[model samples]
Every structure is written in C-alpha cells, then in structure tokens.
Target: MTLKRLILSVIALAVIVFGLIVTGIWGPSGHNPAPEQQVQTTQTPPGMSRGEYVAKMSDCTACHTTEKDKPFAGGLGMPLPIGTLYSTNITPDKETGIGNYSLDDFKRVLREGVRKDGGHLYPAMPYTEYTKLSDNDIAAMYDYFMNSVQPVKQANRPNDIPALLSMRWPLAIWNWMFHEQGAYQTQQDKGAEWNRGAYLVQGSTHCGTCHTPRGVAMQTTANDETETGFLSGADLAGWHAFNISNDNANGLGDWSNDEIVQYLKTGSVAGKAQAAGPMAEAVENSFRFLTDDDLNAIAVYLRSVPAVSEGSTSRYAQGEAVAQDLQLRGLPIETTREEMPGEYLYMANCSTCHDADGSGSPDGYYPSVYHNSVVGSEKSGNLIQVVLHGVKRDTNDGEVFMPAFGQHLSDDQIATLVNFLTDTYGQGNAQVEPQDVAELRATAE
Candidate 1:
C-alpha cells in the first residue's frame, strides 16, 4: 500500500462514519416526528365524543400546568441535561395556544410528536410512549383538548438550552434512532383485558417512565415485555423505582392482582409496596381516577406478564444472615422499656404535634405515621430523617412545616421510634439500627 493510498483510505472511512452518524442510521432510531407531519388532522376518527375520559387517562394537565394556573396552559418546567424546558400552552387561544390547531393538527402532535408548523417536539412530552396510542385514542385526546379543556391565553417560553442542545435537527436524528413511530398493536393471542392493560401501560400512561431501565442516552431501554429487562426497576432522580415486572426478587412477582388494584386506587395497599415521590403524583392525579375495570385490566395484564430472572439480588433475600449478624453485633433484637426511650421521648417532644396514634393532623397538614407509607418501606433512612430532622410538607392552601427533631432525640431514640413505626405500620422487613440512624443523619446534614 502506498502512503497516498493509505491517506485516501483513511479519508474515505472518516467520510463514511460521518455520513452514518449524521443520517442516524448508525443505531436504532429515536422518536422524532416532524411538526407539520404530526399535526395533520385528516386522520381523526369520524366521530368521537369521549375526549374528557381520554384526557384524564393521559394526565396532560399534571405536566402541562403549574399549581396556580389554568390546566394545560403550560407553565410546568422540567429539568433537562442542558437546561430546563417549560411546558407549552395547549389552550385553544388563537394567539398563544392551540386555538388555531384543527383536530388533524392536534392529532399530528400527539400521535407523531410533530407540531402543525413542522417542528419536532422534545421527548420530555413522552411522545415515545404516546405514539403507541391507537388512532381512536389520538382522536379522542384531540377532541378533549379542543372542546373540553378551558382555554387560557399564554405564550410558551423559549427553551433554556444553548443552541447546541436546542438544535432540533440533531434531535430529529436522535429520534430516528430510538422512537417507535406507530400506535400500539393489540396482541392477537391476548385477551381483551390484557391488551387493554398493555395499551394503557405502554401507551398513554407510560408506566415504563418509572419502571424501565435506561441506556446512556437516557431513554427507556425498551418499552414492552418482549425485552426481559422491561420494568426491572431502575434508579430515578434520587430514589429507586421498584421493578414492576413479575420477577420474584425485586419485582412484584409475589403481589396478588387485587393488591395491585387496591394500591393503585388508594395510596395505602399494606403488605405490598406503596407509592412515593413522582409515583405519589401518579396515584393522586391519575391512577386514583381510573375505572375499576381499568384498574383490574392493569392488574390482569401485569400478572400475565412473563417473569424475568434478575441477576442483581435484593438485600432482603439474605435476611436470615443479616439478622444473625445484627445479633452478633449487639444490636438489640427486643425493645425493653429501657431501650425504648422513644416512648417517653415521643411524649415529651412529638406528642403535641403528631398525637399518640402517630397520626398527624387529618387535614393533610402533617403526615400521619399511622397511614404514611414512607415509614413502612424496607429502608428507614427517610423515616429516620423525618423524625431527626423534621420536614415541611408541601401544602396547597397554606404553609406548614415539620420541625427538625435531631436537636432533641438521641440516635437510639430515633432508631427505636423508627423501629416501632416499622413494626406497627411498616411491612415486616429487617429492623433498623442506631448506626443506621447516625449514618442517615450525617448524610442529611
């Protein structure tokens, strides 16, 4: 090979690589819909009037509006890698909202992640999930936004990302790699209930947002049961989103379908896992409103899912060993009156505010330990902090805060109270230790 020929070969290889990268054919495509293509209204169903129900299922209002504003007028701002992205106003205001959007235009955006003007929507909208909705669902959603939602005149703020991050063309390429660009297909072999559940979880509700694992690109690795890892639990903002698959280890393989339905309907579905963080939002705003049929369908679908074998073992699996070690370490297994200084400690410090039942104010002021799920999780870190360093609950109508108790309660007392709460209300997981309290306090500090 001559030196000139080698140089030409290198140049050709570089050009080929660049071409593949630019064209987005180097990897699986992401969900990227052109704005104009997405907003086309010609595909709307002949007649659909149940738009309100569809809108509720979609939970558009939760992300689209801030607490103080009109629903879907678009003021919620979500954090992104580069910068924050504000929600867009979806009201039918001709000037600042979707008033100009025809049914086809609305359909295009929701169905394809494209706007009427031919711009691509950011993935933050969960279009990757929404694209799986049936065309009927898309039409119903369009009607709901158009006719049912109240219109407010509001302008969408420009994205906070720099030009490099905000560039839509690159996202178009990214979408080409990852986005699934069609409505969900009902499995021919599945029952109607299972299909309904699958559609709900995979499409409008996007259960995978919390359950699915993510790749380096920050998108859910895969959206359905065909992927063994789907719903196999992944770490979220700060906490772990528990696996929802039928895996016997970390997932819900042990939970009965009824328990799942009950948990979804109410915040408390004892002995099983409870909702918290963003999941709390999902429960309060969305799941709580689902029809009994829908809830059952969800349960049925989840139960029918084939279980996956998880290589990552759960800490609870080694409970017997952990318990023996705790005893060896002189961690008290039984709470004598002397060891349980928390009883007196609670009377002196917390009785006035929290009450003897461990139930705080019922008006949703202070969290009630009698019913609070946080005190009941396997991990007591959050509960220890709540007792040691009190927290202020975010109230809608007023300002109220839980005072910090670290100044008053010793590590032992904090541990005892947490243990009491866990034994009383929490599931029968392992007991917490004073060392655990100290570690949690230090971390919070």
Candidate 2:
C-alpha cells in the first residue's frame, strides 16, 4: 500500500476508537437543572410512608453522609488508584445538592449512572446495583430525601484524580461494557418471599459491592446470585468482607433461617458470628430496621444460594476454649509490653470481655472467641482489623464497643494476641506478622 493509504487507514482506526470513547456524550445529554418546586400535599402520598425504610434498606448513609449533622450532604472521600473521589451532596439543597432534580432526573441518576448535566457517575455510586431498583422504590427514595432529610448548602468536594486521567468520557465505555441496566428480573421457580429478598440484596442493598469479588477493571465479578462467586467475599481497604454465600465452611450454610434473621436483627446470633468493621455499619444502619418479612426473605434467599465452600469444617464448627498456658499466669500481672507473650496478652487485655475460658458474657453480649467465623476464617485480616480498630456495632440492644488496641499495643503484640485467639478458638493457621499489623494500622481511618 502507498504511504498516503496507510495514513488514511490509521486515521480511520483513530476515529473508531474516539467514537467509542465519546459515545456517552452523544446519548441523552441530560436536561438543564429543573427549577426547585415546593411539593405540599395534605393527602397521604403513594410511597411516602415506605420512603425512609427503603433508604435504610439501601444503606445510603454509609457512603453519602460523612457528618452526623449533614446527613445526605455527601462529602465522604473514598480513595482510589487514581485519586480520592468524594461523594456528591444528595440532599435537596438547591445551591449545592440534588434539590433541583426531578423524579425523572433522580431515576436516571440511579438507573443510568447519569447526572442532570449528562455527566456519567463513577461506579463508586453503585448505580450498577441501583439499576435493579424498581420505579416505586426510586420514587420513594426521592420523596424521602427531598422531603424528610434536612438539606445543607454544602458544595460537593472535587476529586483529586489527575486531569488527564480524570476525563469522564472513558467511563462511558466502562458503562457500556459493564453496566447492567433495567430492574431485576424475577425467577419463575423462586417463591414470592425469595424474590423479594433477591430484589433487595441484588439491587438496593448492594451487598455484592463488598462481598462479591471484583474484576481487573474494578467491576464486580458477579452481578447476581445466579453467577458463581457472587457474595463469596472480597477484601476492602484492609478488612475482608466474609463470604455470605451458602458455603458450609466459609459462608452462611450452617446458619439456620432464624439464626440469619437474628444476626441481621441484632448484629450477633448466638454462637455463629458477629458483625464488625463495615458489616457492623451495615447491620446498624440497614439490616436491623428491615421488617420481619423482609428480614426473613433475606434469610431464605441467603440460604437458597449455591454453597461455595472451600473447606469441609464449618467456620462456626472449628475452635475450642481450651486453655493453652496459664503457665504465663506465673508471670507478673504488670508484664512489660515487649515481654508479654500471646496468651499473656490475651489474659491482660482480652480476657476481661471475652472471659478466661474464651466464652463471652452470660447474656452473650461479648461474643465467644470460639465458634466465631471471624476467628475461624483462614484470612486473618478481619481478626487483625478487629484487634487494631476494635468493634463498634450499635444495635437496638445498645452500643457494643470493643476498645481499640492500636494505640495501646505494639504491632508485634497484636500479631501475637490474634494468633493466640485463632489457635485457641479458631482455625490454627493464622500467621499474622508485625509488618501486616503495621501496614493495616497505617491504612486505618
């Protein structure tokens, strides 16, 4: 071919690639901001009553709200590979929030990941999961936020991603490639309750955001329960979102329906597991408030999912409270920080709440270290996190607070204590090191 012909061919390829990248710009470049309107009605609206519950179910507070005083006036900064992305103000503040958004605009934001200005939202919004939300739920959410929530005039914080890498056009390609549009499809074989549970879990609650593994592109590997590895767990920051699938050993397989409901209701179920880290937040804000029927539905759906076990022994089945060494009991109570052995560390610090026998309180407030999934899991990340940061799960039962040992204990001491707990009451394979604790502590907020 002639040089001129070769140049023309290259230009054609460039045009195709550019077209693909800019495709989002060509589509419904959203409307100008709608004027703020006062909506007053004496009559009860269709979804007004259900609005708050749906918002709780969606767990919007976890990401959108940073300050207690400024609930939906979003400014929660989530760090990314590129940079930090701050959440937008979702409250109905006319100056700096979604106050001017129409119901249609709101729907588009959730379903299409598009804003009123036609810009695409990063998947951090979880619009992929929000796409499965029904029209009614979306309407209810809008109503709740616009009416009930107190809006502030706080401006949305700008992201810190590099200018060249921060271009929005490329996200169009990502959306096209990965976004699952439309509401969730109902399975014919599943019962009504199960379907309801599936709808909430797979759609609004966005459980898979944490539990489901991600692909190289930072997209969820599975969108729904039908797919393999859905809710099979993933690592977040430093904590691991435990497998919530029906897996007997690692997931919720051994949990009865009542036990699942109980766990969701109170953040702890007898002997199986207790919520901590992000899961605790989820339980406190979202799961605890769900209606009995909805909670039961979640239980049913969770139990029905295909088991994805890696080990035969249930995580809840492993571990005993047998004492290793009160031989260290011979040591002085005021042992030096550097000199305290693992068992000695537990006796000094942990044994008060967890008890000398590793069994929790008589009322089961402080959970038994034995028969606990956090202890039993092979990845000791959660165990390490709990040790460093402590557990803060506030349910109806009242605040459950475990004092963080991060400031008080050395990295070496934490590693030793966690290993002792796992070996005595969990799977005995934990090999946490001082470096691991230091690294995780460095990342802790």
Candidate 3:
C-alpha cells in the first residue's frame, strides 16, 4: 500500500478507537449489580430508612425541591450563566419522576448520567460526583426514592438554555472530556476513616460541586484531592462558597479539627464562622444529622487538605473585638455628626441581634461579625446575601433566625450596610456597590 493510504488507514483506525472509548462502547465496562441486589419491595420507608440517611448524605433535597414544592418533587430552578435549569423530580411518580425506574435504570442514571428512557442528564445533577458512589449506597437511595417518596403530579420544568446550549448530544462529548465513571476506590495508604471521609466528601456529599471553582464549560475545576483548586472555593448562585482548604488566611488553615467538626454538625463555630445560604441548608438537612464518627472523619480529611491562599487575613487574625461606640447605635447625638448611612442602617436594623459592637451573643449562638468567616472572607457575595436574605438555623440546640431585609432595604441601603460591616468588623475596603446589591437581590429572588 502507498504511504499516504497507509497513514490514512492508521488515522481512521485511531479515530474509531477514540470514539469507542468516549462512548463507553469499548474499554473496561462499568459495574453491573446482580438482579438479586436490586431494591427489595419490603424495605424501610424513605423517611425512616437507612437509605434516608444516605439521601441526606447526598443532600438530594437541596437541588430537587423548591421552596413551595414537596421535598424531592423537584422544580427548584438552578440559575446558570447560560440559562435556568430546573431540577428533575426524583420522587416515585411514574409519569413525572423516577417512579418507573428499575434498579438498573436508576444505577445507569446515577453512574452514567443517563435517564431511564436513555436521555442525557445535565451536569447540574452532579452525577460526575454521584458516579463515584458505592453500589450499596445507590441501591439504598433507589429504595428510598422508589418506596418512600410520595409522588407528585408536578411536571418537570423545562430548561431555558439557548437551543445550541441545550442539546443533549454535545453533553456526550462534554461527559467524555470531564466525567470519570466508576465507584470510588479506597486509597491503600490512607486510614479507614480517611478513606471513608474521602468517599463521603468526593462521592456522596459532592462537596466540591459547590466549593471548587469551575473552568470553561462550567465543569468543576477539581473533582478530587489531587487538584490545587479542590475545595478552594466557588461562587454559587448569589452566595460565595468559602474556601474550606487549609490556607491560614483565606481558607480553613487555622480551624481546628474540633472546630471543623462543630461547624459541620451545628453549622456554627462560636467566633469563627457560621454556615449561611447553601452551607446552612446542608447543615440543616444533611450534615447536622450525621454520626459523630462520620463528622470526625470529614473533619480529619478537610484538615489534611492543602491550603490555597488568596492573600487575606486568617479568621484567627481578623476576629479582634471592635471598640463599642455610641456612633454605632445611630443615636440622635451620634447621627447628627457624620453622614454614615451604613452606620445608621446597621444600628437601626442589625444592632439589636448582632449587637452594637458587632459581637453576637457571648455564647456564640449569634456568631460575632468580627472573626466571622463570611464577613472576614475576601469575597463579599455571602455578606451581601446574608444581609438581603437573612439567616436561619434550626438544630438540636435551638433555632436561630434573621428576617429578610431585601424587601425593606434599598440597594443603596444594603450596599452601605455591607460596606460598613466589612470595614468596621471585618477586613476593611470590601466595598460593595449599590449596583452589585441590586444584582444580588435579583439573583436571590
């Protein structure tokens, strides 16, 4: 054969091989559970089952349920830069949800990102991370959703992404480029606790879905411990998912293992930081219910994470007490001297709960603004969101609630309040613009 013909033949062969690999038509096959391993009909109800605990670990309700909808009935709108993609109903509604799915069908969706009818699921489901979940966990979850969840007749909301971006065919290519199929492999060198933590964080919990930054095409920059940006931080919706890394300044470097455990279990750590927005939801719905051993394992794994600095002061360094001044009270005498709108706003609206000195209750039930992770962080998104949406945490301890100020406070007022809080209690010069506030409000809505 001619040299050119031979080269052409080799190129064609290579292309065919690449195609097979990408489509999973070749290469090592994925795990296929035996028929007997399928979900049993007489399993525990989802509400009180071990599978319920597994679902909480997955935090399924956070995405699948909307504010007004029944849990797992879906319709939660996930706003993306491209467009809005509503979450699918995972409830066992045969027509609108996964009710008709068999064990293999559910497994395929979770591990391969394919639906019961052979449709591609968007990456928003975090199947990339779910793919790593163990077969047992998958079976348990299947049982819970299928047997326990009440089916709602609500139809799935259609995504508003542009046609070019919404097509499922391209996702096949995207999956090939970004996804890794299979269950999580336990690292031989790591202890059992660390391995378990790694599985929970990387597989079931999918913590990196929010905490890790995204690259082009909006895929998480890191999926596991190997990448530099893993759990470094990411902006989600209107909130900033703070760096959970060990960076002494911008990350959790100064957080003790116990502190991490406390934060996960209770969503607050006295003067350090309190969970808000998505993190708060996770705590309320998922983490708070986890076993002490599981929480400790997570803490150990997180504490071992390498730090990724972003040139900011540590939470330890930033929590110095601010001097109490009458000016912070918006008293007539103090208000007449300076035209600080933010100070007045804070005094009038925030001081009663956060305190005039910006120190929360002495017990840390109301976390002090000073040394607070949200306030101290470089990103002002969470601070802005907390002000607009307010804060609420309910646990075994008690309920902590803050009323939403978005309806009452103007963009200018919020900007003023945020700027004042950051300058006074946190790292100064974290200026927030009125326009920024307006945008955040819209996003939150």
Please name the candidate that would achieve the greatest TM-score relative to the true structure: 2
Off by over 4 Å in 1: 1-49, 306-445
Which lDDT tens digits does candidate 3 get at residues 75-142?
Answer: 88877656788998888998988889999899889898998878788899988988877777788888
Kindly give the number of clashing pairs for every candidate: 23, 0, 0
TM-score between model 3 and native: 0.87
Error of 3 at 68 (Å): 6.5
Runs of candidate 2 with Cα error greater than 4 angstroms are 1-48, 329-340
The candidate that wins on lDDT is: 2
lDDT of 1 by residue, 1-445 (tens): 3446544644565566578888876854434433332221222223534566567667777688775448888977777766778889988888889988987787668766788888888888888888776666677777777777788987888878766456565556547556777767667687778788888888777888877888755778978878767877776544456667886655667667888887776644533334555565676667766777787888888875566665444322321101212222343434424554545455556657655555555653444554443654565655676677565423223333567788887787787777766665455564878898787666541
Per-residue lDDT of candidate 2, residues 292-372 (tens digit): 777888888888677777767677777777653445656565663346577778877888888888888889988899988
Worst 10 residues of 3 by lDDT: 37-46
Give candidate 2's error at residue 378 in angstroms. Answer: 0.7
Where does candidate 1 have its weakest 10-residue lDDT segment?
319-328
Task: For candidate 1, report its TM-score.
Answer: 0.69
Q: Report every candidate's CA lDDT.
A: 0.65, 0.81, 0.78
Candidate 3 residue 264 C-alpha distance from true site, Å: 1.1
